[model samples]
Target: MQIGYFLSCEEYAPESLIQQARWAEEAGFESLWISDHFHPWTDEQGQSPFVWSMIGAISQVTSLPVTTAVTCPTVRIHPAIVAQAAATSAVLTEGRFILGIGSGEALNEHVTGARWPATGTRLDMLRESVEVMRALWQGDFVDHHGEHYTVENARLYTLPDTPPPVYVSAFGDKAATLAGEIGDGLVTIPPDADLIRTFRDSGGAGKPVHAGYKVCWGPDAAACVSTVRSMWPNDALPGELAQQLSSPKHFEQAGQLVTEQMIDESVACGDDVDRHLDAFRPYVEAGVDVVHVDQMGGKRQGSELEGFFAFYRDEMLPRMRELAG
Candidate 1:
């Protein structure tokens, strides 16, 4: 699997994100994954810039391909609007942009006061929204009056030469089946071979699969874990807590239960090159086409963007390409 840097929109400001894009290209990362969240998971993260603007700025600074780690086109934003933003992004990046979409969490979607529908209903909305976006992308006036959304006399004129591919994010079998049926690719987290197998068996065979991982790197291993625990404890929350929590403060409360050991074991905490490599092995073994690493180390004082890139450039990139081969 190829390695790419994941820009955490929730953690860094727009300027830092842009600079990281440039450094990631120089560091030999093949692609970029930028989170598309409306709010930080916790106040500790402290940043959430509009992802479309960041993509435009990043395009001006680097030639690396960009994809939203995942966007929710279902509720917080309409699918037609998302289609337009995505088209403009593709143009800005010279057609090197992809639209990764998901069923979304209430944290972002509830801002519009929209009902946080049941999971099945949300998935259905996602599927219909995708239909709306794709139909609009064809450069024809789309009139869609589906069960959840209505579109009357809508057309997207500024589309990429080819429509941007949609990569659906799935965390369970039901979602995976829907993704295989509609998505051009699959976007999921961690490295579960069973999940990948389900996608393939559900008609996603040979499609690209992108998995996300979080890791920490710092001078002191213990400190690294502490930083991760402070900034990303939400990632280790059990079951559907990550999805059901409606507010950042709620997440922070739930995160209090997460232990340092959980963060250390799940994330490759510390600067050990071998440990970092092993963190990605499960994804590779699962046949993921791209492994997007979001370095949670930046919160630690010593772990700046340059240091992070240097670690990948001098230590990880070459070995990773060999593994990908």
Candidate 2:
């Protein structure tokens, strides 16, 4: 299994993004995946940078392949704009970029005074948006009128030698079937196994698949959980994200549900190298093509990286290679 890093460009300045990308590449990470969002999800999280601009900058600085973990093309930004930005990024990277996209959350899409559509509607929009984007990337003047979008006489003037490939993310069966039908690849956060099988059986031809899970490599598990709560408390809750979005103020309330036990289950927060390797096993066994690891220590440097790099490169990656083979 190939190892990759998932990051939020907002948390790191351009210099830091470049620095970490280089570090990750040097440390043997196969790819870099960055989050795309206009807002920080909530005020408590603080920063949200233009992910495309950051991607362009990252292309200039690192040799590692890069992808948006998942960009939402249906709202806030037009699919045409995302298509153009992706084309430009591919050219700059000399064809090392993959466009990872999904039906986004209300927290990001609703910021523009647009109603956040239900999940079913969002999935419909996603299918249509992908069709439009693929048409635009072909470098021919195109006119399209779809339920969710319309473009007239549109063409991408600047494109790479080969158009960037697109990877779609899906958490459920219907969405997974759509991703397999349309996307060149698939991206997910520790994707459900049934969803993967659905994609495969739905005429997917063994395309590339990427899945990510986070690790808070700190000495103190409780401290790590506390740190994660500071940024993403609602993530601890076990329910559909839409169910939790009834009240925006509930983010804080949902955050309170996150406890040390919850943190320990998902994240490799202790000092054991063997434990970290064990944490990543199910993903490999599930046939994931790329195993993305988010080093969730955030801004905590010094010892965090010191321990993480040692455990990951020395122990975890090697075992993963054996398992994958």
Candidate 3:
């Protein structure tokens, strides 16, 4: 399995993100994953930079392949615009980018004042969006009308030698199956072996499977847990609440339901190297081809962030490779 760093856009400014990309590449990460968000999950997280501009900066600084952990092409941004941006990103990165997409969350998309559809309808929109993007990536003018979107005489003038791979994010069987049918790869968070099987069974055989996990590496486990509980209580929110919550305030209110114990149980807190490995093993065992690790401890300064990368490079990445092998 390839190990990568997950850039939490919600917690870092654009320049910090570029610096982290450099640190991650120097520290031996093979690739990168970045969250795309219009707003931070809570006021405590404090920052959310535009992801495309960040991607442009990352392309200039790091040679490592980069992907949006998942961008929502179905709403807020039209598929044509996403297609153009993604195509430009691919060209800028000299083809080191992957367009990782999903059905989208209300937190970002709701800002456009569009009605949030049911899950099934959202999935349909996502399918159509992907289809539209793929059509535009062919480097020809595209004009079409679809169930959920329209493109009128639009074309991407600048194109990469090869279009970037499209990875679809899925959280359930139906979405997983849809990913199999259309995606060049699969992206998900948890290490659900059944989800992997579902994707593979439904025509995703041999496609790359990517997963992400969050950890807090520090001297004190309790302190780390406390930090995560305060900054990322949203991680512990259950079911579709994460995708359905419409605003940062709503998320902050919902996050109040999350507990320290829950955060401790879910996140790999503190500097226990073994604990970190244990957190990642489930994804490797579930057949994930790429594993992205996001360091969670609120907003970290350069020195602290460097320390985390150094620790992972020296103590964790080698063991992770061995375990995967």
Candidate 4:
């Protein structure tokens, strides 16, 4: 399986950003995936730089391909603008950029005074927005109307020779099927083999499937889990992710649900190579094309990367790649 790294770009300093990307690429990571969030999801977690500018810098700094782990085209940005931004980024990266998109959250989408649409409406909007984006990316003037968008005489002028592929995110059956039907690839976090099958059956060809899991490796595993729970506790629960995503005031109550046990279950927060491989097996079996290993060490302020990446590269990655091959 392909190995990739996920960064939030929460470190605002340009040198820090370039160093991190360069380190990951030099460490044997094949691709880079960055979070596209306007806010850090909480005040304790500071820094969310302008993602597009960061991507441009990343393109120049490292040879590894970059993708937005997931960007929302439904709310904060118009689909037409997303098409343009993506086309431009792809050109800058020289065809090494893939646009990973999804129906977004209120934390990022509420900036424009637009009311957060319900889940069903958001999915509907996601489908329509993608349709509009694909049409515009074809470099033909688009005159299209749909529930969420209407584009007239719109076409991307700075289009790439081959348009960047769209990778849709989904947490359930309906959305999974939609990903298969419309997306050239699927970007998912939950390692749901069923969803992968759904994507394949719903007119989705054998396309690229990307899945990521969090790992917090250090001398102190418990301390690492504590840090993870302090930030993103909901990830601990196995089947409650969809519910957490739909929670009305999820971020406000983030601290209440995240616990040490929860973090222990979801993250590879130990020194054991066997444990790390065990954490990654489900995604491999699910037929994931690319497996993103997010070194949650960034939360601990760079204490974990040296140990984690060393173990990952020398031990776990080779075994996993053997299994995948």
- In terms of lDDT, the best-performing candidate is 3
Residue range 1-325, candidate 1, lDDT tens digits: 6788999999998988998899899889989999999989999998999999999899999998898989999889999899999999999999999899999988888998988888999899999999999999899999998898989999988989999999999999999999899999999996878888888888899999988888777668898899889999999987777778899999999999999988878888878989988987777788999888887747446345577789889998887777777
Q: Distance (Å) between predicted and true CA of 234, model 3? A: 0.7
lDDT of 4 by residue, 1-325 (tens): 7988777554234555666788788778899888787776544456678788888888998999998988999989999999998999999999999999988877778889888887789889999998888888899999987777888888788988998999998888988888988899999997888898898898777799988877777777787777676655545544533333433246537557666775676688877777788888888788888988876646455756666667767877788787777
- Which ranking of candidates, highest lDDT first? 3, 1, 4, 2
Q: Stretches of candidate 1 above 4 Å error? A: 299-303
lDDT of 2 by residue, 65-115 (tens): 998988999988999999999999999999999999998877678777888
Give the poorly placed runs of model 4, Cα more than 4 Å off: 10-15, 237-252
> lDDT of each model, Cα atoms only?
0.88, 0.78, 0.90, 0.79
Comparison by lDDT, 1 against 3, better one: 3
In model 4, residue pairs whose N, Cα or C atoms come closer than 3 Å (at least 3 residues apart or on different chains), thus clashing, are 233-258
Q: Listing every candidate in turn, what is its Cα RMSD in Å to the true structure after a full C-alpha superposition? A: 1.1, 2.1, 1.1, 2.5
> Over all chains combined, what TM-score does candidate 2 have?
0.93
In angstroms, give how far residue 106 of model 3 lies from its true place. 0.4
In terms of lDDT, model 3 sits at 0.90
Put down candidate 3 lDDT per residue, 1-325, tens digits, no spaces: 7999999999987888898899899999999999999888988888889899999989999999999889999989999999999999999999999999999899889888999889999999999998899899898889989999999998889889998899999999999999999999999999999999999998899999989988988878898888888888888888999889988899889888888998888889988889999999898889999999998863643355677998999999999999999
lDDT of 4: 0.79
